[model samples]
Target chain A: MATKSVKTAQRYAMVIDAKKCINCKACVVACKAENQVPLGVFRNWIDEETSGEYPHLRMSFDPEQCHHCADPSCVRVCPTGASWQREDGIVLVNEDDCIGCKYCIIACPYDARYHNPETHTVGKCTFCSHRVDRGELPACVETCPSKVRVFGDLNDPKSQLHQLLATRRYEVKNPQTGNGPQLYYLL
Target chain B: MREPVWEFLIVNYLFLGGLSAGLYFASALATWIQEDGRSAYPRIARWGALLAPWPVSLGSALLVLDLGKPMRFWKIFFHFRWRSPMSIGSWLLVAFTFLSLAYLWSWLEQDERQSLQARIPGKIRKRIPARVQRWLDLDASLWRRNLAMLGFPIAVGVGIYTGVLLGAVQARPFWNTNLVAQMFLFSALSSGTAALVVARLMDREPVELKEMRFLYSMDITLIVLELFIVLPYLIHGELSSLAVKEALAQVLGGPFTIVFWLFFMGIGLLLPLAIELYEFKPVILGKGTFHIQPRWALTAGGLVLFGGYMLRYIFVFAGQATGFR
Candidate 1:
């Protein structure tokens, strides 16, 4: 049962080629529009790393959202089971079930979720399951001019995402939290 | 300026009031059980029963008042969704209010003079219906007992829900943690105890020294736990940790420090602990009950209540201000 479950698990992941990212924030805008995210709260965000004080300053931007972890901390602490890791490894919120208690918000080490002021409930990225179900890429990935975000099923051996992940070394955000985020950043 | 702020404030007030009411009810229960002769347990219990519902109702009202569309508040009940904390809290508040009202009515109707007169068999020439009298007596007592029994957990549950609500948000580093709800629960207990103590002192009722001592010890323990839970997160070098540290520093050293140290720690915990400890020593040594002046108890209670409010305000504002920067 365990082997079959593992074998059949449709793990979806995103590989971001940081070198190719131009920091245009197209992904952020696209995600906001697609999700109808409220003002002052975001499902996606950019983290900037800076180096040098003066003469030679350089900057790098890392766009982040829910990493849809294999062992999601948000799921673990949720008292109502509103936040759950789907069979396909997608960390999703059943908005209808969510109590707007915001436990998952605090448990998330990455600060990926937000409480919608209008709805009085929690909201976050769901890896664009709606689009994925319709046989399309996530809005952010589709809108990205640089094609920096590579999304696909990790379980499929023939998938480009699977082949790339197998070949390249990548890092997940806040690995210490033990969430095992599916989103990987190429060094 | 923002709608979320109003929502946050409403939630804050509800939690605070619920906590205060819970502590009051608990102390009242202690009075009911202990039945000490000199102690003002009955009065306190009566007051607590009467007082518990108003704050929550008012807080709920405040929530509606702050709503952009006030009339829509009823929609929460009609369109109840288990997924919404507001929805759950709303229904809980309604149930709690009804329970509280029943409890209050029972307490108010138990007129000692009337009961004493009735106890005298054939004292009243006018015949009273046995069934009506029995029903009145039994129903009142039953409701009072039931409400008192159920009140404790419900109050605590509602109070703790506030912290859980905020803590559940993974997006805000300051508000996130399982400890958040526990912290909120402690705050509620502390605040509720303080409010009742203050009210009791105001009424010149012989305050429960033992109860005060217990509350003081609990308050100090909770504050210490809160500090312990926050210390590691603040000092950790991660980005979120650093942000939390910055916010903590602002609280510890900035404008909020006076309230945090002077009111919350010094007056709220330290002064009360010192006095209670002094009393404990004498009491334990068979030197008679430590007589705490009503004035001192009231002062301490007021400070503790202030401290509780400050704690919540500091945490909520600081958490929001520090996140993302």
Candidate 2:
């Protein structure tokens, strides 16, 4: 059984250039419209990190979303396999199968998923799988004016994301959970 | 500290339903054990069994109704996943409902006298079986008795499932402990028993005072134990200290405090205990039997039932809100 391996590796990931990000909130609006996310809720968020005294304070915005962790707690705790990790490493919800229990919303460390009041089902980003399938980037990436977000296959050594991650220092959110999130931020 | 209207409504329904079902089942068990005239006890048990499913089913339905796409509720079963507590709880509720229905059917078709006759055997069966062939069948009664006997475990199992569902979520520190399931189980039993007492009181029937006293005492003891288990966890700073402290504050002093202290502890526990104490005194005085004014018992029972529902609502919603923060 070990020798009959038929592996199909498609590790999808995103590299965000934090220094270039201006915290404009464009990506947030675009994501909401594309996914039809409910009002007063978000699939992605921009967390602000502040330092120093008020007059001279410096602030950094870290946009957050489902990290699409390799070891997903949401997937592990889901009683009905409605939340799943795609082969490409994108964590997505099968709305049709979801019981709307909100267990996944609780399990997620990033607070990425939301119970859509309209659908009565859990909703979140799918890495714009439909766009990706059509040879286009995610709505957030396409709409970002500063080109802060870069999307590509992590396995391809020549890919811009792979090259950036290889040569630059980066960070993943909530490293303590050891979820090995696919999204990275370049400091 | 302030809960949304939706949260309040949903949690209230969940707690009330669980308590109602639990009380109904416990009452049926009490009646069965007493073996009072079938008309005396079974009538009570039958009403309880019939009433039990409505609240739980309605509560669960309300939960679905509150969801984003209520129509897609069926998808939970279509693509069942063992990793989600909601899925497991849903399936368990379905099974419990079916089992309860069978139990109810048996009770409705039961021939109380024939069931007594069955205990005697042969000659009685022949005479009664021939004479009452049209209106009375002994076989159905046997099946109902057997099914109802089986339902006791299933009933408890269903009650425990609610707790296990919440307890299994390790990520939510407030809900991750084993005590949650135990707490849920105890609450279910307390609520279920209280419901039975109230129903009997309402019907103006002989309120199985002795049995009610025993159940009430047991409920008080379990609530005390549940409080003990909950205290250390609430005070400890090891697991998500901020969240735990916030939750404790919410229940003890925040908006939820009134419901937790005034309703759950006071009415659900204290009131029931006070009445039971009076009832137990008569029994201890060598009377062997006591008469509790049905109206008084009914009032106390109603308060206890309401308190039980409040307890669940406060815990579930408070736990969720704090964990999220």
Candidate 3:
């Protein structure tokens, strides 16, 4: 009998374009509405990085999500089988099963997970699985005025995300973590 | 200025875990090495063997309380995942609890026998109830030792696992280091010995001052070792990576600097080290009678234990100060 979690066959991934991002935060609002995310907690958001002196400041927005890494740190630290990677490669948490020890939250280097005080469980970006299953874009992607967020299967070469990756250069969050993070940011 | 997810419960839990593990190991070792000798160590061993299980049990209880969904805490036991550090840690806690309880029970029964033997008149000793005689005949301390034989590694496992819990998180660059386990294990040993010293002094038992001094010296060495392992996270973090360097800077010169350096490094490490050093010295200036006032020993032990708790808080908070952007 296999004692481990079932494995995934598909690897869902995300890519963002910093250059095209306008910092409108529509995606953040859309994610909150789609997930009914509790106040003070988030499933997805935009992080702004600012560099250069005050007189010559340059700021850029990078939309962040769960990353759904090939090797997820949160999945490895969850005490119960509360957190798991689906066969389609979307990393998710089972709120009912979660003991809410916060180990997964601490394990997530991206700080993507947050404890939902209302449910007394940890919550994170689910990649709008409900919408994706219905052959629709995620709420965040659908609502984005700039359409900076791209989500799809890396294995499907014809997908928009795959096509974008093939044509553009990008960087994943914390490459040194060696978790094979799937969130890629295009310059 | 976000608050850390972990709070006093975790800090308190880790310290209690270390204390119980250290106490159990020290007692088991003393029992193994003990001969027909007049020493205060036997008293230390007795106290340890008797008191080892409670703190660990209490700490585990505190952990359960700290959980977001305390009711689903049982889910940790129903499913097992080798890939999960928490899965392994929960199992270790269960194992440690069982073994430590057994060790405690053995000693309790031994105390019963000693009391029974002392109360019975020699002429009536043989006439004692057969079941009572049978109970008294069993060697409880020896039974505890056999339990210890299995419990020692498990105890050490619990101690190191606490550190590994944080260290294994690769996303938290400040915590993702091999050094945490070394510092934690050494602190466990030192704090455990200090607890023993405090217990012995408080009891006012007949003991060699030399043994007390030796424990202080040992604690000072462990303190120095812990400092060497921990201070580098602040010193060398800037050279690691931009993300990691920022996280380190938050603790070194950022808002957390005061608590990190003042409370943790200052009061926690250096203060305890200074106290232990003074205790390590001879009663007189150079070579004189060894002395340790119970009050002084208690103060040093309390400071070391406090320092141990501070280390955990720093790890949890500083690790979260910065994240991938």
What is the TM-score of chain A, computed separately for every candidate?
Answer: 0.92, 0.92, 0.92
Per-residue lDDT of candidate 1, residues A1-187 (tens digit): 4565456667898998887888899999999899888898988877788999897998988888888888887777654566777788888887666656554665676777777789776788988999998989999999999988999999998888998889998888766555687898988
**Fraction of native Cα contacts reproduced by each candidate:** 0.10, 0.47, 0.90
Preferred candidate (TM-score higher): 1 or 3:
3
- Local accuracy of candidate 2 as per-residue lDDT tens digits, B1-325: 2223237556755675566457556645644664444533565566677677777777777877766556777777776667666777778778777777656555654466456546876776667655565444534544645666676776776777777766675445556666777777767776776677666666656556555565556555655665666566565623445545555676767778888777877877677667766765666576766777766666666776676677677767766655433
Deviation of model 3 at B303, angstroms: 1.6
Per-candidate alpha-carbon RMSD to the true structure: 7.4, 6.8, 6.0
Q: For residues B1-325, could you state the per-residue lDDT of candidate 1 as single tens digits?
A: 1122423555457455655456545554644464444334566666677677777777667666655345545655665546545556667777777777667666766575367546767856247678756755554644555567777777777777667666655545566655677767766776676677677666655656665655555555555665565455445523445545555665567666776677666766567655545644555577776676766666666766666676677666655544433
DockQ of each: 0.10, 0.44, 0.65
**DockQ of candidate 3 compared with the true complex:** 0.65
Show where candidate 1 strays beyond 4 Å: A1-9, A29-43, A71-108, A114-123, B1-11, B14-18, B35-40, B59-99, B110-139, B142-183, B204-259, B271-293, B320-325
> Which pairs of residues collide in candidate 3?
A8-A87, A109-B171
**iRMS (Å) per candidate:** 7.5, 3.7, 1.4
Docking class of 3: medium
On a 0 to 1 TM-score scale, where does candidate 1 land against the true structure?
0.71
Cα lDDT tens digits for candidate 3, B1-325: 3458887898888888888887787666555554564323566667777778888899999999999988888899999988887799889988988888777766665567678578888888878889977866677665655776787798888888888877788777777767877778777766777787777776766666766755676677778888888877556766787877877876778877888788878887788788777766664357665666767778888887777777777776777666654
Better of 2 and 3 by lDDT: 3
Candidates' TM-scores? 0.71, 0.79, 0.87
